[model samples]
Target chain A: MDIDNISELIPQPVPLRDIDDSPGPCCMSFGFDLNPLIQSIEKVGLINPPLLKRDNQGSITIIIGYRRIKALKSLKADGAGCRILSGDDILPVECLLLNLYDNLAVRKLNDVEKGMVLARLIPWIKTLEIVEHYMPFLGLPSNRATLSSYLKIEEEMEVRVRESIACGQLSLRNAIMLLDIDSISRSSIIDLISNLKLTVNQQRQLIEYTVDLSHIQGRPIPDFLDDQSIKEINSDTRMNNPQKGRALIRYLRMKRYPSVSKAERKFKKMISRLNLGKTVKIDHSPSFESPYYRLEVLFKDGQSLREKLENFMREDIDSLRDPWKKKK
Target chain B: MDEGVQKYKSTKSILLQLKDIPVRAEKDDGPEEVACVSNELKRDMGKDTMHLVSYQGEFLKPCPGTKEYICCGYQILNVGTNCPLDCSYCILQTYFNRPNLRVHVNLEEQLGQVFQTIDSDPDKIFRVGTGEFTDSLALDPIIRWSETILRGFSERKNTVLELKTKTANTAGLLGSKYRDRIIVSWSLNSPFISCREEHGAVSLTRRLECARECQSEGFTIGFHFDPIIQHSNWMDEYRKTVDLMDKYIEPEGIIWMSLGSFRFMPALKPIIRRRHPETSILDGEFVLGLDGKMRYFKPIRMELYAFLNELLHQWHPDLGLYLCMESNEVWQESMGWRPETSEGLGNYLDERVRNFFG
Candidate 1:
């Protein structure tokens, strides 16, 4: 086929010929929509009309744009004149390829359709089949496994992605990440995503919250959690071996060395020195990058912040007023 | 009838006097009788306007295992409760302590606080909807709360308003200047469920007609099939609902639609058990969700989602459709897709609204 003079090569419609609608191997999938093509037709006046081919028996058949043909039927019903130019009016190979390329590019399959496509495409159908079926293998050849992974991503997401999509909170990226998370943590993943209004990194942190793997970007998970006690432990550990990144999940869970009093001393020292917010953020330190404790305080203004600090000092003084007897 | 029952029944104020009104039909009743009771109840109750007690602002803490707050999404204006239309599975029966159909009569102050919050974040888009804890438009005829919200939000670009209800009260909404900013959302159910589960509610066609009118008036419409119950012919019923929606409302005009399967707390089970003993909602197979709410099992949910999703995609291909609060695997299995990233969904939706209206 001549790449530029492709229009002359494509077979045009033989107006009086009968077309078969049987499920042929060459038949396009019905799951796709034709409205975009119809829209294109109404917009640019069918810039490249659908390519038609004549069977050995002299009947004209559509190699593609089954949806477009159907839409034209509907448009014709609404008094829009429909016509199929002669076989000589076939679209250029380059334009035809571009049209199909744009059509598939523009088309977005729903979750189920995506799943169905994935279930059929990546797992079963071979790459040669796609190449042979569509015949435009010029740019970014997509293999079955690659498409399958895309499908697998969809297959794996949290229920909230669907629910959020239904409720309008989730996006395609959000859905894929939700799928990457474990099923048990899916709801939590969605909740964290929507409620916290978390960033992508934070969302990933929440998804990794349950998983033991908390380290990301060479930073300890405790650093991500912003726990003060964990940071103190990290600093102590760093002095001994500068590059050794500690896993906070292990420290919090294992309770190695440092007795309860020692840990409490460390905690109090950190809390007193640092500004602990009204509500303390206590993370399980499930990974090296997470926190043992984080604090966030809300103050309307600088004055409010001063007042809150004063109120805290007054409470501290009030606690000091109570005399306690030393007992053994 | 006994004197007490008669006193509570005949005296419109007494019947309407519940702090948390429980409305489950003892038997199927006529719409006229319901209308008559609601009319008398409104008259005896006298005033029907928003009486916002207070803008209860509290730090909504997160729940266990989930970083998200199990929020009512938007703030609760607490306008009224116990809809005149008796929906069989009305959440109000157990959700509210008092359902005496109370409307917070103080609109100006409530609007003032709302404006304060909205003005607080000029750069941030604050979505404040009225139907979070109650039906926003059930008392629309008398209260006209949506009009007030529409009028208030018309000038504030930072805030988007949603008036969600099961009622087809669009008369108050028509010709509003804030039609673009205010999304007129409706809770839709299958005709079968509407007839059996919902009483005194307008017919499905009527609701769709109202939606069509709103859409034509340049208002973006939203449909919600929340508490999508499991029934033998639910697939056909939902398919019909989607079909009617496609026929009536313009596809591009739909801002969003939500699908939530029937879920209930353990506390609500007894209410349904006592009130709607014959309701088939509880009869279906169920399992406790991670949230501890009773929900239909995985397979049932998958079936429901698959059927409804296919119908919706076929009908309104571009319409924004999402499932409410479901897990990732279920989202993947039923819808065959998931969010690529969790952070962008809200922004994506906000952008959709901006593109449509802004």
Candidate 2:
């Protein structure tokens, strides 16, 4: 059906209570804010009447303008003008396409909304069709992996996690990581993420460390996160949220990689004993994967360089070895 | 002997064998079906199915080795892709886009061309193996790959065909009269890893027993400790496997034994986690190497390789111990000597081949 001809339909008054305001089959909106839409309807009366389909039993379902109807309902309007289509006149897929195209023309759908659209399209069209045409049309990467991630978002994620993703508080990549755990663990992790206000990178590190530690320690994620040290870090008054996040990640990393952490601590202790001055420093490769260590010296002139080198060479220069190596 | 003969006759040809197996033959239409399906569905559907297609790619190619590490210049014999054994740490999980136990049905017809390539370079010892892409003997019971290609390789002088496997399906090898220039190798790991991670594989004791049987039948065997994982009491656990080797057979008949720590591409982490959630293989402290693969920390890898090298050398001094794809520092520190470069490692293995077979 040509959706352009729908404008020719006459408007009728439908009682707000009679229409099902819940998200219908064609609705792709989720974790959306109604304030802007509500303000718009308050400033100017409903500019375009919401499209609704009435069944033979007189039950009404909103096809478009779900947000508009929701705003009107909040405004306590008893009835509003709506463009009604007989349920038999239009197909469900056609209604979905109409809403999709209408929404695409006016605004961009958030990640959760895109997931909702894909979830709805999955029942109507083939996955190949959605991947080739609808995914790109919805501004998502046209790949099965990306499609699978979005489907999980819509189908498996809890509402609070979806809200976190939609509001840009949590990243979609991090949210996908939470899907591997149970709902309770996911909720607790989401709570920690929100409370700490972690950056995307920190969120990823937290989830990775938590998951790896859980697997290694043979404990669930909630049980792992409920350790006394973690709780102490979270409740520490001296540290801010970002500090708490970093401290929690450090704690988990130490637990996950005990040998690496111990080696790092040993190196730190040895370096402190050497008393390398402000201008002189020593460093090792990340994780000590490289067999060599670096000695850096900063000087103002050639004479200063020589003096600093001579000074650095005097006190236990031969003691520097692989941190994991025992003294012979 | 009659039942063995009948079983061989039933699966002698690919077309004849298809009658016995439960398979759905789909028409070749397009790439849409394979490309668009979810990985979970693809894995479930492809696990038990076999697709017989005439492979059009090069039948013989060099192992794709990175320059950052010393690779033992082995060549890959493209007999098939994918494996029946679903080890949790298998790199084949994310390596292939299409799924199935794809056996190159035209391998018999293409043997002459592969031999021609090796014959063209007579001076270059082609250390070819069929276990790189798929297990060399996992499907040998039905596909009869051994019956078709064993005689050709047995006749060649400059090459050795290594049929590597984790299975005890050596009936085909023993059934064939040809034994020269064929190395029957088994991928050995700790019994804990074998039982927990390697799904559908035989037990460690069974594998060692098969190795002993092959040795008694005048077949020189090999063992690989590639992907030695770090778990609880890993040192003691791995010792159990080496001790089992001591009980089964003499180390004097063994050829090369390789030691390699677990490494994988970054993309495979999620796949492993999803496919095998209870796996302890990913619990090590991993760092990105120059080759862009995540490997155990340098110290951890050295520890593992060093322990195994000492243990295996103690079993037999001439077991031809080597590290597969390790740097010069790692070689010197772990194995107590350095191959220094890929060519150097290749020459070392070639020398071992000459000493054993010549």
Q: Which candidate is the best by DockQ?
A: 2
TM-score of the B chain in each candidate versus the native B chain: 0.79, 0.94
Overall lDDT per candidate, in order of appearance? 0.54, 0.87
Question: i-RMS, every candidate?
Answer: 23.6, 2.8
Candidate 1 lDDT, B1-358, residue by residue in tens: 1122222212233235443644332221212121123323422222232222222332111111332212223334444445555666776666333324544444534566667766887876555567755677777765566555677676788767778878787787884566657788888988789888876678888889998998888888888889898776888888888888877988888888877888877567545644554566665545556666767655567678878888889886767777776765556767777643333444656666677767
**Which one wins on lDDT?**
2
Which segments of candidate 2 are over 4 A away from where they belong?
A273-281, A294-316, B1-12, B28-45, B95-97
What range of 10 consecutive residues in model 1 chain B has the weakest lDDT sum?
B27-36
lDDT of each residue in A1-328, candidate 1, tens digit only:
4334544554344332254434232332434456777787677654445545554456555545545555666566232222333444444332334344544675643443343333343333454564345322323234433343345544554444655543435554545544533464566446435643545544443443322223212234334334575456445633432121224333433332123224444445544544446532322121111112343446788998788767556543222210111222
Candidate 1, superposed: residue stretches over 4 Å from native: A1-328, B1-77, B340-342
